[model samples]
Target: MKTTITVNGEARALDLDTRVTLLDALREHLGLKGSKKGCDHGQCGACTVLVNGVRINACLSLAVMHDGDEVTTIEGIGTEAALHPLQQAFLTQDAFQCGYCTPGQICSAVGMLQEAAQNWPSQATEDLTAAIALTDAEIRERMSGNICRCSAYPQILAAIRDVAGEPA
Candidate 1:
């Protein structure tokens, strides 16, 4: 299958097998290794990436499915010279222990923040009509999909809160 996906602001034309997952395409084909393949299944949000500004598990999605779509991996979120706010917050808060899940965590956080900004409510939301508060519960609920095996939830929460402009 021939697929052209604009990844990290660059259009990449790849000739991949239909079975090639987005994760494999990014890591093996395009040499973008930030998005990890922790479980290969969608259960672990280790392969989360933004597709057209929406987050999805790249491991579970086929590369061909993303034809003509815009994808954003952790690399696209920020560069080494200039870290994304979330990335900086994660560092300031010491959010990761092993650092293996940091890429997915940051990518998911970017999408999660955008979703909250758009007034998207999570299960923690008390009032659907009210503005999103990004409360601790809200952040936890919204980020529940991405798990940190090191149990760095506190730091992760703090990092997210810092980025969300909430007092930690």
Candidate 2:
């Protein structure tokens, strides 16, 4: 099967097997290595990416399923000269210690803010009908999927809250 994906604002196509996972397609074929392969079982958020402005685990879906979809990876979030606010917040907050999970965290954080803005219901939210608020509890719930083994979670949460305009 042939699929065209808009990755990082670039149109790219590949002849992939229907069984090929999006993570494999991104790393193996497209050479977008920002999304990690952590568990490769959808259990880990390491392979998370934005699909049409939503965060998803690339390993959970097939490449053919994303035909003509707008995909955004961590690399697409910003450039070396101009970093995304979440990237800058992560850097300033020292969100990662080993750095392997940084890509996933950054990607997840980017989409998370968008999700929050959309009034996505979270367990921490006292009122779901109101505009989503970025409380420390809510940030933790939204970022629950991404794990940082280096114990940099405090900084990670701080960075995300900062970008979301929620104080530490």
Q: Report the C-alpha lDDT of model 2 over 60-140, residue by residue, as the tens digit.
A: 999999999999999898999999999999999988888988999899988989888888888888986787778899999
Lowest-sum lDDT 10-residue window in model 2: 159-168
Tens digit per residue, CA lDDT, model 1, 57-82 = 99999999999999999989888999
What's model 2's TM-score?
A: 0.96
Q: Where is model 1 more than 4 Å wrong at Cα? A: none
Error (Å) of candidate 2 at residue 37 is 0.5
Looking at model 2, the pairs that clash are: none
Each model's backbone clash number:
0, 0
Q: What's the distance in Å from true for residue 156, model 2?
A: 0.4
Q: What is the C-alpha RMSD of each candidate to the true structure, in Å?
A: 0.8, 1.0
The local distance difference test score of each candidate is 0.94, 0.89
Worst 10 residues of 1 by lDDT: 159-168
